[model samples]
Target: MKRNKFWLLGTLILTVTFILSACGNQNSSNSSNKQVLTVATSAEMATLSTTKYSDTTSLEALQNTFEGLYRFNSQNKPVLAGASKVSISSNKKVYTFTLRKNARWSNGDPVTAKDYVFAWRKMVDPTAASPNSQRFESIKNGVAIASGKMASTKLGIKALGTYKLQITLESPISYFSELMTGAPFYPQDEKIVKKYGNQYGTTAKKTVFNGPFVVTNWNGTNLKWNYVKNKKYWDKKAIKLQKVNVQVIKDASTAANLYKTNKLDYAMLTTDYIKQYQKTSGFHSKTIPLIGYMSFNTHRKTTANIHFRKAIAMAFNKESLVKNVLHTGSTLNGIVPKNFAYNTTTGDDYRKDAGNMLTYNLKEAKKQWAEARKELGKRKISIELLTSDTTDSKQIGEYLQSQLETNLPGLSVSLRSIPLKSRLAATTDYDFDIVYGTWQPDYADPVNFISDGGQYHLDDDYNNRNFRNLLNEAATKYATNPTKRWSTLIKAEKQLIKTDAFTAPVYQGGTAYLLKNKVKGLQLSPYGTVLFYRNVSIK
Candidate 1:
């Protein structure tokens, strides 16, 4: 799974517009009326294409507008959506799915099994340069196809007929069903994609929808758009709201004013407004399984030294960063957040099992810094820290700079605050000394955080053969042994954090927001699309 970065820049508000002039009957009952829900987000939608999007906001938009083989229910369990039936082979490596006959796109085209094959193949095609290509590495020939060693046509997905889909995996993934609920696994309309070519998914009119809603008024760069109900959806009757208007609001005060004036039904509160609204009836907070950490550019000589990385990690205090700077999250001891993954046998939280691998020790940090200086034969070292230009991120970056410089002698730290897109691009290009990033789980599994050859390892150029072998053993060797796989994953995490010190664990993410009492049925999950609006209704 790709690592997701969280930004606490601004507020997103959902405004409910009541249509009183439609009819007298509509005025009598709020539940029976057609309403327009106007919502605000901190950032604009990057893309609607399932194969290319990488942000949480884009995932939420895609989740509301597209249906996959399966969908997560309110309880965060996988439920059937596009596929009506499924069967697993005796070896559990092959999966056969039966597409719903009534499933139709917003353009009135029948959604067939061919759509799945085309989408999966296109995602793994090296030419596409998809950030999510690694998610399909479990499929047969997926690694080879992604690395350009083989043609995309050799991918292990096949459309048996118009409505039958067959997918062959190299190994049995325990969370394969939950993985299907992600947008990356959702099918794409090949005809629409070909017709639009390079312009596909750039705008609302350029794409087709198979879910309960279709996006509108988005011109690829605009900050406002709408999600209109898709009448052609197979289960359209279950959808309540007819239209949902979305906007990007970058100010917390503006969101507060909108909420106070009844212009907004739901608004995400920043730390500045959390205390002010905590006593209010609409205040809501959710602790998600998102962990913030700093990735070292191992390619750089200074950061490549394990002593230097350890010095930086131990110099700063995560407790102070979370309690004072962020004011919403909890301190993290490892890459995986607390209350996230549990031991399969003992049901113990992974954090409890891993113990405290990260700590604050000024003395040990000084010792590590001296060793690093001796190894590199340098009296002074300067490094740049990269972070998003969001209010919270800038604050965190500033705090880190102060803490490191104050704790370590002969150390100079510089902060580079860039927009989220630019920061992501820079991180991908390995253009910084140390970059602060976050990772949210795609599924409720430790492998999602510490997978072998996954985002965590590949992005930072941290190639510990033993670490990779441990993760590989857990996935393949102990494929059916739950206890063994659990122990192996714990070892891999230790190797990454304690042994190599490739990255520094910062804090876990927490979302604080306000929702009107009238809004109902909005489902929030810790993994995969944080927000679900399919069953949402505004009373």
Candidate 2:
């Protein structure tokens, strides 16, 4: 009897030991399967809240974790992602989308049409204070709700069922579908959002993701963050990377050094390092639709004079600035960037159609300065220039100050390099004489930019009712007529650039980067400079 009892005890112990050994092996295998891609960005993500933030840094992070009804693919073309099917009305003022039934949040909650409704309403809520709410002004009652004239519930989006969503528009916008691919239009989980209140999206554990990856290891203000593949994503099979590690290295030299040590898979190149790596194997140079320009505060005494603005615009050498200083990007001939918009009739680029309106003529600038001085009844003028504190921005600001002071007699430019958010606030508060600003296109349409309610409109004090009227007519009367709309917008571009000189178009921005050869399938889209990493893989 004693021997039998001992044998049974030994068998049970062996079985338990075998189970524990199998579990340990499984965990080791899982750890080995985790593949991480490490990269570098210039700045930390300002905010993860979709509606409150409108910068590319935030958008890049959000797009990887929270998908919209539509998404730009690896080729930068609009493709359906969250939505399975979409139908549009004949008048083009209404749209209906059918969501993917299998899509679920990282918390295992089903993503429904009601989530979209909640997000859209929150975006335009009067109390929300969302800076990006204006992007949805084309939706029915969107402008009214944002302006506090209508209730948030009255905004033009509704859910017909668990998966069907309907939207009404005030007018037929050609780029409406493309606009839906952006981060601002992504859905938010109402219950989760409300549960967290002000703490939502402030930490990795506080937010829920439904896209390809879920943010992890973020402390809301850390220099580093991680993206872990979400197993619950409906299209998880297509996501090749198991993890992505991003480090914020604001200095270009530091980023290059990290790349050299194989610590980074990608690094952005500034003028200082472009020459050294121009012939490197992984180096690439591409121009996007980012436009860098100078905004003059028309309310200021010296800048209020139209001739003075024109003199400042023509005095600077754009070509030299592009080649000698920037070492990247092309000189801008007009406000709208090159290869940004197209002519529906001839299929030519809008910049090519408009031709070059900005000129670099010292003689003409001197003549205009003389007229400006006579008009102001002052021999000397001083203006303060506000710009971001980034290395490239500081370099450009110092160069501008030197050139403007040397080329234009009796004119002095004082440059102030502030943080990005602070610079934006200063522009909104009208606190500076001039501010160096860069704008990325929201969509393909020219009307989307260079129209009323833009930064130039707020800053430029020039009384150009004719130009404003032209823009309004194009936006409304010619909204559906592609040819006429393009023509009218072209006229507006010429007037703004040539006749009024509302803002000086400096250059079309470009990004030069060093990417590892193994990294494949990352794309930079035309709309809003959105980056798509859905197909990116390290092999």
Candidate 3:
């Protein structure tokens, strides 16, 4: 009986050992399958449609999962991505591109020339209700077609064959290639959209990717996306990192804690904490063009007063505001920020007249406030300063409230801290007297600064329409004749600055993010883009 019991025990031991060995192998396989990388930004990815919504968080996230025909390399210039070859006609009006033939979507559908043509056409289609469809107007006949003047067939793009794309434009744009490097020109698979109906791309699952990674998961607003390297990608063989993991980390303090615990690979710092991490062990900063401002409701009864407008502009000192609020030296002098590469051919200067315009002149500001007070019928100029209750916004508002009342006698300012979404809605609906805002450059050109900074009406959302109209006119003139356009845009920009004071140009900021040590060859453009995924890899 004792011998029989020993034999049974031996058998049980062997069984347990086998099970443990198998579990170990399974874990090893899963680990080998992934090369995870996470990025923690300040906000949630607002939308997956980068082309339709130009929101910063959306663009940053979509730039990774979706790709364009061309991508900017580490040198801050555009290089061919899916395109096999590129050529421009002698007149510089026509461009020809040959797409790589073997590329396929995440679902294995063959990506063809017509797929690109369909996507581009939809961008300019008026019925599409695209906010950024205005970008495609650069192509020949593109504006008229986008404006509903002609059928999209008249627009200048043609699929020469299954792998060829031809584009014609009205002007010789030196930045055309760079413009195509972003979502404004990224291709969308038409087959997936046709299959899904109105539900297409509403969630991460509904979307398809032709780029190096595809989003594998999302739960409505809470995104848990993972990227699996695309086997159908043209240069997929060169890809070293097989996977990417991104979790939504919205709070800056929480992100810092994650980094300290080694739970995060990369994270963004709050303005309050930037100084401490400026040169710390994991710190990495890159400066890109980012402009900040506070816009007023030009249509409001009190806000419509030109002197009232000018009072706000002169009330806040840009330098002190940046130093006090942002704690950075990025305070801006005028509307057109410094260091944005100037294209001189437009004859006259297009840069914002920062010198003579509103600078940090407290005495002058007090004088202007008195004049504005009289102009406003000595009504003790009081209005709501609409802004989100964000830590930065609230802090800035407190400072501004104190400064404005001290500088402008009889200026009674009421601080309103609304939710971020509410602030945005109110600004869109023209329900706010003054609100905090910023303008990000769409392209490298000066036109980006002048088109009311492209803060035009966003889909029936009420805005300073008259100011936007003036900006549009200036943009058109700049496109046709830059020199003349510069003069006109400057005049328009100044009209807001010197006249109605549509904005208090606070400070022009820049982009800065941390990168993991294991990640290699990650590059960001001066215009705020991460490009050339082909070379990015994990060590």
Candidate 4:
């Protein structure tokens, strides 16, 4: 759906904490005055390559290690990074950026315009298979290059000088500046990439950093790593946290214990810990732009029936799912969540306009199930539910299985727990009857949510040409008309999710965490990357 690609765990790592204290590379001789902050994350990074997998963990790491032409400031607004000045044409199809003279990589190499060119070419190269390549479709010929209709050299990015970069767009996009802050748009060094080949970004040594921190102690496999402040960073003075220690803790209880023991400066809280630490000091509930939904495989005979699909969609109670199960977030109204994006015309929330398309009514569900059974001449159906192997994912899967089977009689649901990679593979390959899914926006637009990209691909057999056409029109024909564009995309979302029931929205995601009161300057932005630790410091 959206490629901000941070995976939001369905369940809290409330108790799982792997011991990485002995695994850290922080030498005993390091400066005693250096401020260090230890934080806990539920999962390990799959890769550091920006154009590769669009998962959340890798994006979190990328945000601290790389600099694009622009970045989201603490206020979640796009601010210049590598570029000192940027100019736009009247038609908004052309953009010119002048790079900062002091912009240097961790290795002290000057970040040149050619670096952006190289990265852009690599991302759109058919062989690269970058999930993010399609994001450049807004740019002139970007779609052609990604679809293999045009050579990578035919792309619209150009370098007039070592420090000057120019970009030509296919049309005027209001959120172009916000898109610049995405990980895929960040510059990459051609020399280093060629030298590393397939091994690029596989390990700390293989990667280079140009942002606030240079990653260290990562041998490519371990869950423990450190972000040491980059001395060569152009804005190093603003970086207060000298070192940020990160440990992958799968257990929520273990993370809470670590936070309680001062072993971790920050830990995301579960329902139990939320109440346990509400008055303690640094308990914060952050509303993020992540939407969790249940994706059904229409290829399955039983699921292919619209009556059966609506029965399944309405059988589960979203209120209980968010309140009793999630306990931290609100129930989702539609595919898009609340406070995620707004209507450009009215400035009101889009969720309010979409209203509640999904509702829980056991009586209505049974009626639909009976109609579906009569159509198929079947009294009962069995299917497997797929989810990640993590503690939270398994728990959510179990809860869903129990709820679905219990509420809808004669329906059987078997749970299959697999590794994150395998879960993604199974879902992408359409190997599961139903599976857990998440989508996070790459920019500040609802179009990112409605657009058919990333993990939002439904089955191919269920074609809605009108829905697809509306999306295309919104991106092109109505790109400048905020009101028409918003209305068009809203209709598309309704067609895909509510009317057709391609996806079932369940919950709006929020991260409740416990942090030391002394910690400051860490920005939990709603767009782009999840957490920014550059200016973070201890009081």
Candidate 5:
């Protein structure tokens, strides 16, 4: 009886052991099935519709699901996608493209020429209210129609067939190709747009992917997300990763912790942490296309005078700010930096032409302030500075407040910090004395810096004060002449600096994220747009 009992016990133990081994194998297989790159980005999406996008966070999310007619290469120059050939007419008025029939959306729908036509028209349509419509003015009549002078259909884009598209333009634009590879021109399927009317792209499930990944279970505020591979994507073989997960974290310290714990694959270092982490393992940094500056409310009674603007611009010791507030990159003297921001005509660089004394000109600034005080009644004026709650923003605001007061005796400045969205609204409404503003270029072009709402000519052109009507008029001349445009842009930038009208502040550059060594194929250009994340992978 004892021997039989022992034999039964041994048989039961072996059976249980086999079952547990099978479960372990199953879990490993599931994990190995997909390679996911987890990204930590704030989950603020502007809008699902590519045209109406205003927020950077949301646009980055949408870029994963939709396919543009042209997509940016690692260098940010446009490359043909669904299109087989893209060419401009000799006169530069006609742009033609032949589509590749092999392209398919994630839902197995054909990506056709009509899709491109519909998307382009939808963007510039006055009713479309697309923020990016201004980016496409080089397309035939695109400028006039977008300005509301011409009819929506009058804008120069049309589909000749299921796979061919031609864009007519009033003039030539140097950065047109770069614009094509980005958002405002991305094609939307008529079938999908029609199926989900106003609700389309409002949720994660309503959209389809023609790019490398599909966003699943996305919420506007999720610190986490998934970017699943699109098997139907035209270049699926080049996409090795099966998924990408995005996690939002506001604190750089927390981000570092995540990277250390193996919870994050990549992380950005704040100025406070840059020095400490540069000595630790896995540290990296690079420059990006962001420009951070303080926009003084020229509309304010006390601040309205141009001298006040010049004084404020002069107060910024860019070199000191870079050393104290920003530790990661070089201090840029001009608003636009070198190796970036070009002129269309001679391709004269805005940064190179910008005279180099990156250091502050106290004497020049002081004289401007004196002139400003004489223009105004007050030897002393109390002004307010506004900022957001981020660690970087608050510090910058506090620093500015201190600098202005210390440098200029008559300047009494107060500081206030609010949420980012509210601060943006305040700046737009001219609600404060001075507010910090940042601009990320829509496309790589000289017009990007000088144009309003992405277009050059508007009766009210709210984005710019139309600082130089001469420059604006000159830009119009270059509307067809690229060389002439470059010279005019240079002249405008020079005049802008000479007057101390505005400071570019900090040329926020690329981020050197500490990415997990195993991660691969996550590509970015020096001037990267967050919206082009289709081909990124983990392995």
Candidate 6:
């Protein structure tokens, strides 16, 4: 699933209103005596429904409130959570999972294998309209079911009695175990879902949780929520924090003030504030495998031209954008981020193997623009660039507007900044010439980025048969051959970015944040939920 950063500037007032309206003062507990952690988030969660939610904030919320068969630990390694045991068939296609007998939801109902079957089937059902339906294509009959060629009941997942679950895959996935840690694979209670129907995950009361925490006070659109410890959790003893108070604070200065006032246990720093807090205590930063880029609508008139796309791609100065504007990201030369997805045989990073495909050259951009203008038989071209109304996104959109208009002679770029939700809707409808986008991998694999990033969904009219074939071959024909698969994936990336210029690669994401000294055992991961609060404790 595609994850967009939802930091909207105008929502700050709404966030404050919701926080103030929250019942009582949850943060009033004595910090020294109570295991309560107060944190500030940059964005509000879209929804709690695992089958529908797409943004990172909602994924993180779901990760904390729901237990899957496996969960990523502090080391970013898969660890057992709901399932007590797992067995695989000799053919490596069938997996049998045994649910923990003690595992029960907040309602005291034993979480059975039926929950897994229900959730899996719902996600892949064509009528469900899940944006992440393609993620389950590896499951047996998954593609047919998602495409409406087969009934959802035919999906290769079965509940073998009350405690055991069986899953059949069409082909072997190297990262199958790691993939189980994602929220899409988590179980959902059939009874509760049927009862609530469309309103199931819209509010805190409508959802049931079996993970380390149970969400509270979230009324679908609220900016403030609480994560109270689930007493019925199987491993409740391991959960140290009794409650977690989360509030959305998009402004970096507001977050900094909250952090200094001891109201926030964790806060993310923007570029302007990073320098001020660099020498302060509890300051940390890490480079995550997040690729930020721009997606061009190939169906649009001027953007449809390959030369026009190439001109726009080479016009932007990513180095200056990352260093001078966004201080917490690294400029990218390829679709894959550096230090991610290494070759097993040679131990070479995929980025180094792929080499540089994106570069900033005003001379080349001008040349391409001339060709594009000649081919289109137009002297002037106007395009609208759609972006989220976040501070970072606005800065990026402004920079690109200035650079594109200045470098490309006959081009006029207009900026359209909207809320994250509105921007996503417009992008899905292909309502803009170009749009700013970001993609974080679902797991530690190159295919996750290459396939999900833009290959299948970027532009409605952008279809390169060769690029698609290479990816399909890597996933199927070379499934077990790591070396061949790695080589094929590299070729596919080059085809998409260099040869086709379907999308422009921006910079890799780096996160800088402040955590209180009292907060310990917080796990920061590159994939899935970046912050794992399962092991977090308040000193």
lDDT of 5 by residue, 1-539 (tens): 00000000010000000000011111234334345455665323424677645545555666666667677676656787768898888977688888878888889999998888888887777666555666665677776676678887776778888788888765666666776766677888889888988767766677776787787876543445677878888888766666566655545667667667666665666656665677767776666655555555545666656677767776767767767765655665555555667654456666676555324667877887888888786688888887655566666678778888989888898888765445544544557777654445656665555443111112232234345554555535667666666667666655554443544354344454565655545555335435345554333
The runs of at least 3 residues in candidate 1 whose Cα sits more than 4 Å from the true structure, single-residue gaps closed, are 1-33, 452-460
Clash count (model 6, backbone only): 0
lDDT of 3 by residue, 451-523 (tens): 4353434223224556566556654534556566556666666655655555567666644344457666665
Task: Put down candidate 4 lDDT per residue, 1-539, tens digits, no spaces.
Answer: 22222342222223222222222333334423346776667666667787775556677789888999999887778999989999999999999999998989898889999999999988888778676676787888986787688899988899889999999988899889898988889998878888999999989899888899989998877888988999999999887777777777666777777777766556667555566776666677756677777777777887778888788878887777767666667777577778877876799888887777767778988898899889989888898988776666776678878888998888899999876555665665668887775556778777666653233343134468998788778878998898898888789888877787777776776667766655667776564226788767665
> Root-mean-square deviation of each candidate, in angstroms?
3.6, 13.2, 13.0, 3.7, 13.0, 4.0
User: Once model 1 is optimally superposed onto the true structure by TM-score, how far is the C-alpha of residue 454 displaced, in angstroms?
Assistant: 9.3
TM-score of each: 0.90, 0.86, 0.80, 0.89, 0.82, 0.91
Q: Of the candidates numbered 1 and 5, which has the greater TM-score value?
A: 1
lDDT of each: 0.76, 0.72, 0.60, 0.74, 0.60, 0.76
The residue pairs found clashing in candidate 3 are 332-507, 346-483
Candidate 6 TM-score, C-alpha based: 0.91
- State in Å the error of residue 423, model 2: 2.9
Per-residue lDDT tens digits of candidate 2, residues 196-257? Answer: 99888877888899999998888777878888889999999888767777766556777677
Q: Candidate 6: minimum summed lDDT over ten consecutive residues — where?
A: 13-22
lDDT of 6 by residue, 1-539 (tens): 22222211111111110111112333534444466666566566777888876666677788899988898877878888799899999878899999999999898888999999999999988778776676787789986787789999999999998999999988788789888888889999888999999999999999999999999999987878899999999999787778877877666678777667666666666666676777877787777777777877777778889899889889988888887876776888677888878887888888888899878878988889999999999999999988766666677788889989988877898999886556666765668788885666777778777656633243224458887788778867887788999989989988888887887887787777777666689876655225677887665
What 10-residue stretch in candidate 2 is worst by lDDT?
Answer: 11-20
Q: How many residue pairs clash in each candidate?
A: 0, 0, 2, 14, 16, 0
Check candidate 6 and list the clashing pairs.
none
By summed lDDT, the worst window of 10 consecutive residues in model 3 runs over: 11-20
